[model samples]
Target: MEASPSTQSPATKARLRTKTGCSTCRQRRIKCGEEKPACRNCISASRGCVWPGPEELDRRLRKFREQLYPKTTAATKATVIVNNVTPLSPTLLPTDIFSLAELDLIHHWLNVLSDLLVLPNADPACVAGHSFETLRMMTGCSGLKSAILACSASNKSTLSKDPRYQVASLRYYDEAIRYVSDAVADIGHGSKAPSDMLITAMTYLWGPDGELDARKHVAAAITLMKIRYQTAPKQICDSLAASWWYRVVYESVLYQAFFLAIRKPLSPDFDVDPELFQLQGESQHLEPFATVLERQPLILGLPLSLYYLMIAVIKTPQLPEAQRQAQLLELRAELALWETLTDDDKPDADVHSKFQANAVALFVLATSLLLDQMCEQCLLAGSPAELTTTSHTRWQVFAALRLLHRPDVSEMWKRCYLGAWPILVVGYSAHEEEHISSIRSMLRQMVERTGYGEFQRILEELEGLWASKR
Candidate 1:
């Protein structure tokens, strides 16, 4: 009782033919001799050939499979249940989703930017692995990805002197700002603590123009730390100390805060709350803080204790004259101790470590000189011995600067842009023409070598200072 095949409806017939050929062949309504890259039919017809891209093809195949075999049976349901428990597919990770441009930026980050961001002494393999893991965890998150890309692009702009790179960086920064703002707002609503990605993104929101107020970001980061984890100082310290990335970011924030506090303490826009970072009463927490610094000595190429001393100096201005003088002397003694330790250790350390030691020593010496000047200015009197000591420290600082300028550490200096703050401090404290000239030359070379335009701002500020002094 079956109907004849010729009379059968077209819908009842099986479809064995696949539309895998070029678009030209498909559009022409002709059979296509499917070929890789180009179909023979299109070639013969002298037509342009275009095929589905990988994502399109994948979507098409997935749609076809789903349509062909719709799940129905109990066995199918059981299979789905098992699949739910399986590990995430590799395709779901960052690699499969990144655009070509994003991939190139990531490659650059892995090769260069990672070195700039991580602990200087951290193993490259370990840092790369950590970065990869971070990317994987943040696969679909634009905040971290955009931040990383923005940083890379900004650096590229400086290096290549291409304004287009800066434009791209700004675009990425804008996108990242949207995501980070949302996250921060959510956290403000008592959603949860900020993630590592969010924290890291906050750290990277700065641009070449130096328009961003770093004190704001630093304060936000510290505030989040306090609000999220109201635990004892030890628990907080332990958690942060366990992760080198956290430590690096924290140290960087501290470095920026110290620099801003020292350079523009009274500036309205740059003002930060001393209580937010007050460690004076956290005597029990000092051990943990010291432990972290001991383990990651000079990660950002500055003595951690120097930051503490800066905080002490800032706090001392509010104290009684006698107490302030006592604290200043104590700070001076600590600076002297650091200078001695770094000098003794420099000869036995590696080139990178030696550079760090000298960099820290340079800052210590400069800080000592500045502290003496503060005493002389505030008291309007300085003993003959204090004047001699100040002169000696200035000479020692210049000597350390010369050591840093040596050929052996040229490559080291080029890689370490964190030297910017120390260099600026030294430049600000320099009085002699020869020392000022040396500092100016070093700043220009640092800007040229590291491609950090922020240093250019520092150079300009120093120029203004020198002009005023003249």
Candidate 2:
């Protein structure tokens, strides 16, 4: 073996390589004088002087396709996909690349959105009263930061409605994908469990537009959790287990409901017979992480339980008539039981408590939304097989809508960044014209007051649904 010639000396390496120039100027054998970022020569020639990163950075020459997909968007950058490699995936960015505005956005996500989501959004560090820099200093992970920046941009886009925020949102979203892919890739090559920050950030990305991204991160988080289920150090395992079920999974469930609202109908075809599947319950065993459910709060657990139960009820197209009716009765009884229990939880001043109370109520309303329809199909279905003409249907849907607007609800929206989907879903399913009018009025008010693109989008979707119904 040509005994691998000894490694080249640093002096020799330095002498052999030119110090600095834009990749384009270097390729063209021209003097670059490396004008800081872009080369003067490249600037004069109207070509991009892609600077390689500080590490090795022979630098890049931006091609036409770069604008097609940017790593991050400026307030003024054109919005489009960066043809980085794939549309769904982009290359990771260096951690230190954030500008002041980008940094501010990231902090906003940390202090506000992350704090609100502490219960269900998986932000393990309930970072209140802390600066972004402080948190960054305490725990540093590029993948987690990238994910946070992505969510911040996405949330900002909802509030700003500016094309720039949309551009930024897309940019950060791709950056998050790239970062996570690299982190997971490292794990595949022989790393231990992924950073808890990545799991925390994954839960924050739960929203209408980012559900698939959220799920992608979740799948990876679950894998790591399973791999370390038995063998990891207790400290590491505890970090992963801290509210892992309550924050990570429950938050995803909430977003899943939001995303499904306009994208597809929640229930399978009403006419099809639902198969036998375990209904969601507070008591079910989740492999490797049973403690999540075992210890989850009823405030959160109640809605989650309803979500599963409701999902089952809507799919009851082929059920044995007797069993279907019995299940419906059982669910009704459960809803009533929860309502009675939650009365004790409904405090007057604590916004967090109020929000949770309202959330539980919304779950019941959402379940009722489907149950009403399911019950109306025929004599075999139940007594009231028609939801369209029922005054009770109007009242139930409207009641849910009102709970969402209670004084504390707006506070919940400000902090948690909850979407308007569930509120609108109840309205969308409302058959009463008066109830429908109130829903429209409520949505319009929310959009005009908040300028949140989500509300505006909800308004547009509602209109579309109404148009189709008409």
Candidate 3:
């Protein structure tokens, strides 16, 4: 074979030449330009540029470090010197058990999820340190961290239509449930007072977009708050400056309870908690718990009057028929008081709803319609009052739909989460094909922008309702 040497170069014969290249090129056993985003080979082939994930990179780095400095002490392994230049320490790398994928999800939480959880704050100065405070609260709780990861993953799945993230979301969700179960078991021992952190963990476990049942998570949060109120009544009365729990736990539980009330009607046999009613009564007072009564930054913001009224509505189903009707009338009056209030001392209704189809107005109108519907369901249908209620409900539905189609409100509706309940109410009451189509379009746009699949779920329910009507 001393014949003329082969013309081919050694580079062409190398088997591991593209080992550090894009996944597709490496699989194809070809040279890669190693370009970012998309390599030349992938672009030409019209293939996706799939890079190694964080976990894979972490493993590769660990393997390299071990080979370079095997079985070394901490000091020796701390820094790896190269050609008289000091290199970054190996310890500086992410060496913890928490994978980089989860870290990315946490980053998503900081950037997007937190903002989605609440309406814009009225006072920007008060929220200047909110991020640090939230991190401190989440630092020690594994269950809370897992719940957050689960939510983040679910959000990503919705946006990207990726099956992998959904799988990961479910796994983290199951782990969170197990951790919460263990924590509840520990609570039976009275070893720890139900702190706001633990209670907040329960609040985060409510999966709005996932397939998991949310009722249990909400019930757990309510139970934990009840425990806290019973065991540490003093803590409940503390000022916001003294304890952040007063705002976080109270508002979170209240918001969840409000939605639960809307979605699942209370059974006649369900017992009303005495503390819940006490909280409702105290919210109407001017002093003592005035700060508690005042609306803080919340997921749902309503007039102080409306907030209290919703709590009563949530409990109304538990009352006897005669008493329930009386309570409903009382709530209707209270709602009217807020809607028409122009007293110097009272909150201006316009301040809450500047837009024709603003969230607050939509909510008030929707709640009004809901109260009337409940009355009809619970009482005999032939009363003169029934005609007025039905007419008023239809009027509110048409008003909401008209406002919804305006140019200005269309932009607002794209970003607002609070419109959800009202939109659902309008969708349910809507019978005409045009009206139904408009509501469906708005929901689809919201899902496209926010990646909140809960809207999609609502859309599905509305379609099912429409199908039945046809």
Better of 1 and 2 by TM-score: 1
Superposition error at 405 for model 3 (Å): 5.4
Better of 1 and 3 by TM-score: 1
**What TM-score, over all chains together, does every model reach?**
0.68, 0.59, 0.66
Cα shift from native, residue 132, model 2 (Å):
5.4
**Candidate 2 off by > 4 Å:** 1-98, 115-134, 137-139, 189-191, 204-265, 268-304, 317-326, 339-351, 378-393, 405-421, 432-434, 444-457
TM-score of 3: 0.66
lDDT per residue, candidate 2, 73-146, as tens digits?
45223212110111110011222465445544554454334444343322233223222333443246655565
Please give the CA lDDT of all the candidate structures. 0.60, 0.50, 0.59
- Report the Cα lDDT for residue 373, model 2: 61
Task: Please write out the lDDT profile of model 1 over residues 381-416, one tens digit for every residue.
Answer: 433222222333356556557766777675566456
Clash count (model 1, backbone only): 0
| Residue 108 of model 2, lDDT score | 46
